[model samples]
Target: MAVNIQKGLAAAGLAPLHVWNRTASKAEPVQAEGAIVEPSLESLASKCSLIFAMTFDDAALESAFSAISALSNKSKETENKILVTCSTVAPSLVQQLEHKTKSVSVLSAPVFGRPDAAAAKMLVAVLAGGSETEKNLVAKYLEYTTRKITRLGGPAHTANVLKLTGNFCILSVIEMLAQAQTLAEKNGVPREAVVDVVSALMPGPIVTGYSERIARDEFDVGFTVDGGLKDVGLMRDLASSSSVSLPFADIAHGHLERQKAENKDLDWASLAKIVRKDSHL
Candidate 1:
């Protein structure tokens, strides 16, 4: 994701790109696109005016923040830095980071897209936090990487909450597609028949893509069952806190758990296997 973001930036004729990754080798690809791969965190912090982090989870995001905070704001660049995080973490974590990063402005700029979308610069970005000038700076660059940028214009954590909510809706569609395809197969109907109906009705890339994945039995790539379980847990916890009922998520959780127990590394679309078993297919 970081590599592609830089590619978009470079392609759009943006200024000299600076990047730092935990793994030195992983940052090399972007160097071909005119990005300077910094060796240490301090070098990155000192050089970049707007730093965008693409950490995987809360622990990783917090660890990166801690390392930067330990830097003691030595550089003048650090004193006037904008930290825009694109991690899919809890809103509370974003809120905490805002309070903790006394000098730097933190923006919750989570995005909705798979790796393919990111590579193609078609990501949907949701941004919040910072003053109008700060957000505009981040969003201005984000325009190169994302198809649309929705500035929520509130507490920095608002974007994180909305990101999780959007993720839940996406997972719901995958879970539903898995069930629908399995049902069609069990009823002596060709899976393609159901796929055809879904394509004609929904017409969105996600709906059509997953429907075809199910029909083609292509469940070996992309998001795994373990990943689905993690998102499911996040959504369930969010729903519980809000006194909302997500019965479908409860059902998908059970299916994902069963798949995880089998120790099979399958894509999320393979959750249909559990549904197939229940129907005795």
Candidate 2:
């Protein structure tokens, strides 16, 4: 994802990027693509005015923010720096980060898309910041990395909330597709035939692409079951805090947990197998 983001940025004439990764070997590919590899997070933070931290979870996001904050405390030049967090995290985490760092502007810009979509520069970016100026400044650079940008306004956490909810919707759709396909297959209908009918009715990438994958049993890791479980857990927490209930989320969570128990490394699409197994297919 980082490589694709850098490639898109370079394609949009935003080259000469300073790249760094915790694993030095992983940064090699980005360096080969013409990005100047930085030795450390502190070095990258010191040199770049606009830094993007795309980590796996909130814990990693907090560590990245800590490095940036330490640099900000030591250098006056860091005041105007912009920190764009592209990781999927809870809205409350973003709020806490904002409160902790008053020097640099924090823009919560969680993205939506699989790796292929990101490589094609077709990812949808949901952005929120403290001001329009900050958002515009970040969006101008991010345009190269995404097909469309949805600005959610001044509150930084709004974009995080949107990301979590949007992911929940995707998981719900996956669960629906899994069960529907299972039902069709058990009734002497071919999985492909069922997917074809749904594709004709729905006609969207999510439906067409994922349904086809489920039909083919192509559960390669675009997004892992564990990753889906993490996001769904976050959604459940968000709903609980707001005195709301997401029954579908609970269902999806259970399916993902079952999938994880059986095969710990399969993609989230493997949730389809739960339906198939339940039907004794």
User: After superposing candidate 2, which stretches have Cα over 4 Å from the reference?
Assistant: 4-14
lDDT of 2 by residue, 131-250 (tens): 788788888777765899999866888899999988988888899999998888889889899889999999989889899999999998588888888898889989999999899999
TM-score of each: 0.93, 0.95
Q: What tens digits encode model 1's per-residue C-alpha lDDT throughout 1-281? A: 76776777667777468888888888888887778988887778776768888887889888877767656466554676778899888787888989885777889899888878977778999999999989988888787768998889688989988988888777778789877887888788898999999999999888898889878878889888887887788778878988999898898888889988874478877887777788786
Task: Give me the candidate number with maximum TM-score.
Answer: 2
Query: What number of backbone clashes does candidate 2 have, counting pairs of residues 3 or more apart or in separate chains?
Result: 0
Best by lDDT: 2
